[model samples]
Structures are given as C-alpha cells and as structure tokens.
Target: MASEKTNGEQEMPKKKKNRNEELKLHDLLNDVVSPILFPEPTNSAPLLHRIKTSLSRNAPLIPQASRNTARDTLLWTRAGSPLRPLLLISVGTITILALTGLLVFTLLFLFATINVVIVSLLISLAAAAGCLAIFFACVTVIYIAALLVAIFAISTVIFWTIVAITITTAWIGFFYTVWLVTRKSLGFAKQSLSVTSSAISTYSAAWGTRNLKHD
Candidate 1:
C-alpha cells in the first residue's frame, strides 16, 4: 500500500511536467500565428495613388526623343558649345582605341605563347640529350669496370694455379731424392754381406784339409 502511494506520487510529477510542455508549445504556436492572421492596416495605398497622380500631371508634353535632345542641348549650352562635339568624338575615339588595344594584346599574347612553347620544346630536347649522354657515359664506365673486374679475377686464378704447380713440383722432387738415398744404402749393405760370407767359407775348407792329413 505504501509503495502504491509512492508510485502515484512519482507519476503525478511526470504528468504535470508533460502538461507544462504542452502548454508552452501551444503558447508558442499562438504567438507565432497571431500577427500573420491579424496584421496592422497601413496608409500606403493613398500615398501611392497621390504619387501616380502627381507624376501624370507634371509629366513632359514633348516626345521622349525630343525631350532627351532638349535636355542634352540645354546642358551643353550651359557648359560650353564645343564640349558636346568633343565629348562625342572623344568617346568614339576611346572605344576605337580600346578595341585596337585588345586586338594588339591578343596578337602579342599569341606570339608569346608560341615562342614559349618553342623554347620549352627546345629546352626539353636539350635536357633529354644531356640525360642520354649521361646514361651512355655511365654504361661505358660500368663496362670498363666490369672488364677490369674480370681481368682481376683471371689474374688471381692464374696466380693461384702457378702456386699450386710449384708446390706439387717441390713435393715430387723431395720424394724422388729420398727414394734415391734409400736405394743406395740398401745396395751397399747387401754387397758387404755377400763378401764376408765368401771369405768365411774359404777359410773353413782349408782348415778341414789340414786336419785330414794330420790324422
């Protein structure tokens, strides 16, 4: 029961806030629409009619062209007699000069553009030639360097081969010398042994003959 009372109290404030928001929205709409529906009256129509009547009554009686010429003549006479013709002539002359200047400037611009294009083309050609020359030079240098590297490699190989050949020759010569010395020593020892054996056998045979005679 207490919880229900508290829930009802919370819902009451939300409903009141919604009612306030709706009332504010309605007041804003009324304030915006009231002036458009009921605008204040003005005296502009009478003033505009008075202006049209005054203009029609005070308007010129002469044709428009004659009126303009009359006005121009009056102004010219008040200023000076010669100024009117001079002004017309000067305006025409200025227009002619402006057209001539425009034509001359166009021709000059075209000529300058052609010259610029030609100059740029020539410069590009020169630059391309320079680049090609540099490329060829680099290629030549690379070829020369490669040739030098190949020569160096070949020379190193030849030097090592010569060293290997010299080492092999020295080894062969040392072995041959050792074999010759061993062969000479063995031959001398065999000859001495054979001579000693023959001498001993002859002495033994003489001894045996002497003994037999004595007996």
Candidate 2:
C-alpha cells in the first residue's frame, strides 16, 4: 500500500509538468506563428508600408511630354465629336490590317523556310546520288509553278489588291465601308425602337381597358 501511494504521487507531478509544458508551447505558437499567418495590428502596419514601397518601386516614370500627349489623346477620344469616331475607326482598322498582314507573312515565311530546307536536302541527295537528280529537278520546277499560281490567285482578288493600292484608295474605301455599315445599323436600331414603343403602347391600352371594366 505504501509503494502504491508513492507511485501515484510521482504520476501526479508528471501530469502537472506535462500540462505546464503544453501551455508554454501553445503560448509560444500563438506569439510566433499565429502573428505570421494572421498578423497582429503591430505587424500589419509594417506590411502596408512594405506594399507601398514595392508599388512605388514598380511604378512607371513617364516623362512630362509623354504624359501630356497621353492625356490629350484620351481627351480627344472622349470628346464625342466626328473626328473622335473617325480617328478611332481609322486606328482600329489599320491595326487589324497590320496584324493580319504580319500573321500572313509569318506563316508564309515559315512555309518558305520549310520548303527551302526540303529542297536543299533533295538537291544534296541528287548531287550525292545520281539516281535522284531528275526527280529533284522535276520537284523544283513544280514548286516554282505552285508559287506562281499562288501569287496570281492572291493578286487577282479585289480585296487583295487593296493591300497593294495607294493609301488614298485604301483609306477612302475604309471610310465608305464604315459609313455603309453604320447607316445599316442605325436603321435597324430605329426600327427596333419603333416596334418596342408600339408593343408597350398596346400593352398599356389593354391594361387600362381591363382596369376600367373592373371599376
């Protein structure tokens, strides 16, 4: 019985020591890791300062003349005058055409590069092996003929001719096309608004008749 009491006494202190240690660990975690993950007010002030500093570091350094030009451009675009729409349409059309031309040229160059490599390989094979010379020569001629046909097909189209035409013709056609489309769109919009107004008037008249009968 005495030995059993002594063992129980020893276990009680150990339990107390373990509870104290756990409490200290919890306090330490709350002080260190908790502040990092969900920062305290004191830490948040420094974080905001750091963010401001980073944004300042990355901000652009625009020159005064460039800034004034950008401001003027924005103002002109927003003034809602005839010149504004004309300027916007012209810029957008030119940008689209330039991008399209660039894409076409890029694809053409890629294909041309591949064709050159294949032709060179064939030519090398023909030179090295006597049996392939006639085959390579015929292939070369066919390739040249195909390129000519492609160029002829492209240049023959009216739309394609616009690319080679003088700037005056291109710009005039661009404005004419835009004007036609705009007029069509405005006519459609007017018709839609008239139809909507008619429908609403009919609805209101029907509702008034029903309400009068009930009264």
For residues 89-169, write the lDDT of model 2, one tens digit per residue. 656565566666556656765786688689878888679777687777788778768766664554355345344444655
Off by over 4 Å in 1: 1-128, 210-215
lDDT of each: 0.58, 0.65
Choose the strongest candidate by lDDT: 2
Off by over 4 Å in 2: 1-74, 128-131, 151-215
- lDDT tens digits, residues 1-215, model 1? 99999999999999965744444333434433443454347533455564554445333322443445556656765686444444454444555555655565566557655755665565556665887556655654665566556556655655565566556655665676687788888898889888888888888888898999999
What TM-score, to 2 decimals, does candidate 1 have? 0.37
* TM-scores vs. true structure, each candidate: 0.37, 0.36
C-alpha lDDT (0 to 100) for residue 153 of candidate 2? 56
Residues forming the 10-long window of minimal summed lDDT in candidate 2: 57-66
